[model samples]
Target: MKHVIALDVGGTGMKAALVGAEGELLYEARRETGRERGPEAVVEGILAFAAELRGYGIEHYGEPASAAGVAIPGVVDAEKGVAVFAANLGWENVPLRDLLTERLGGLPVALGHDVRTGGYAEGRLGAGRDADRFLFLALGTGIAGAIGIDGVIEPGAHGGAGEIGHVVVRPGGVPCGCGQRGCLERLASASAVTAAWSAATGDPRATAADCSRAVDAGDPRALAVWEEAVEALADGLLTAITLLDPRTLIIGGGLAEAGDTLFVPLRAAVASRITFQQLPSIVPATLKDTAGCLGAALLAWDLLDTEVRA
Candidate 1:
């Protein structure tokens, strides 16, 4: 079977894997990005990770892979293989594709936005696979989304689309890092949920995970905080549904890990908001943290296959 190396670069770490064309991971590894060292250092870390995957591929498949796919958190110029901007990683206009190509000895490389790749994986092989139209919403430290329409993941102009978190949820509520007050992220993101609970109870120690656990344990403060987040998230989903009318809403990232603690109330809130409109079924992501890596691999496969045909 043909194989490709896939890497998902995040602010904290990088996940690398050698994957078969059939989506089976042959080998995987993880390493910290050490992002504080700057963009070149982060790129070096990725190259090293890819080199390890190359070594693993040679050990198992008898030859190093000729293609690689990498997903990075931020606005990625997929057509140019440039990471346009990564606020968390403090990068700007990095020509990652050219560097990866040189490092991999002229091998083909596919670069993409991290969230878009995750949505691509879900649309092709995970929870959103069966839907002709779907939304991949990830509520992590911040919130973002990806739109999958008819099996095509739309990255939009400049590859910065699907930033649903920037949408205003409250008119004059909490301020957001993006210079907006009451943005969806301010009310519904993991950080926001934790902050809300913390402020509500004057407990600086309270966190989103703690609030989730509290909600699970019937803590009223946790319940109230979670309820507010769920309601805000539902409002955002309601707006997305009205516009995109997706068939499925795939929820992923750290916040979604709360399972029923997050989903039950979220689903109900969504149900309560819709009257004449159709409500998309909400489901958790199946690929978890690996979705971006797998999707990057798929992108690599697609790019290489297209080149071969050309």
Candidate 2:
């Protein structure tokens, strides 16, 4: 009846799951992060949520969780278990792993970057499972990447390795939130597509989904916007391929939901641009939204194994 606690904390919400030893999910829950209430409240909410999961495990399974893993957005120093900074949650240098351990009666906890953790799940159990080296990119509100090598995601020297979003794809074209002009996120992310569609269609509420519909309907304007985003994305990805040489590229997030509308042209665009680098098989992510939670569970399980070995 032993289990691990897995939590994926986002800007506005948190998803948690109790996972059995063999990776089966025993229970799942979701809660608001209450980020608007401030950083302290968000921390408190996370602690309380973990505690509730622990209680639930003991009540339902007759055993408390032995370990925990937490995935948080923004800059995270996984080795030190510190959440370096998360603008959405107003966090800075928060020692989240130790706090969660203390709240959970000294249970070991593994902390990770949200995107990296999700990519870990995808690499181990989803799109990149067959590849020794792969890159996972999520094109959501913003674009981010995780580099997976031999089943492990590399966090880099400063825990900021796969930040492909900030890479300038359009020189001096558009302003980015990171104080840079023409970032990849500004050009290729779902939010970017939605913004373009909204402006083009004169619909203030137009979303990326609407843009996809328009593209499907053969709307020339929507096609133009979609192709523009795809081209920018291909440019950014080419830079990554030249540097990393991943065997596979896994694409996920809200925009990827468009399926062939995004992938068909993207593969061709990337193919046309490659000069010397080997072409990577670009595939859609299979795990979807459950990746982060499942990956947190994987981290918890890894920690547990390490502890037992020690």
**Candidate with maximal lDDT:** 2
lDDT values for all models? 0.90, 0.96
Q: Supply every candidate's count of residue pairs whose N, Cα or C atoms clash at under 3 angstroms.
A: 0, 0
In the range 1-310, model 1's lDDT, one tens digit per residue, is 4699999999999988888989998888899999989878988988878877887788889988969999998888899888898999989999999988888888899998888899999999999989999999989989989999998898776577789999898988887878888899888999899888889879999889999998889999888889889999999999998888889999998899999999998999999999878988999999998898899999999998899899
Collision pairs in model 1: none
> How many Å off is the CA of 152 in candidate 2?
0.7
Candidate 2 lDDT score relative to the true structure: 0.96
Which regions of candidate 2 are displaced past 4 Å?
Answer: none
Q: What TM-score does candidate 1 get on C-alpha atoms? A: 0.96
lDDT (C-alpha) at residue 294 in model 1: 94
lDDT minimum window of 10 residues, candidate 2: 19-28
Per-residue CA lDDT of model 2 for 120-220, tens digit only, reads 99999899999999999999989999999999999898899899999999999899999999999998899999999999999999999999999999999
- Candidate 2: lDDT of 20? 87
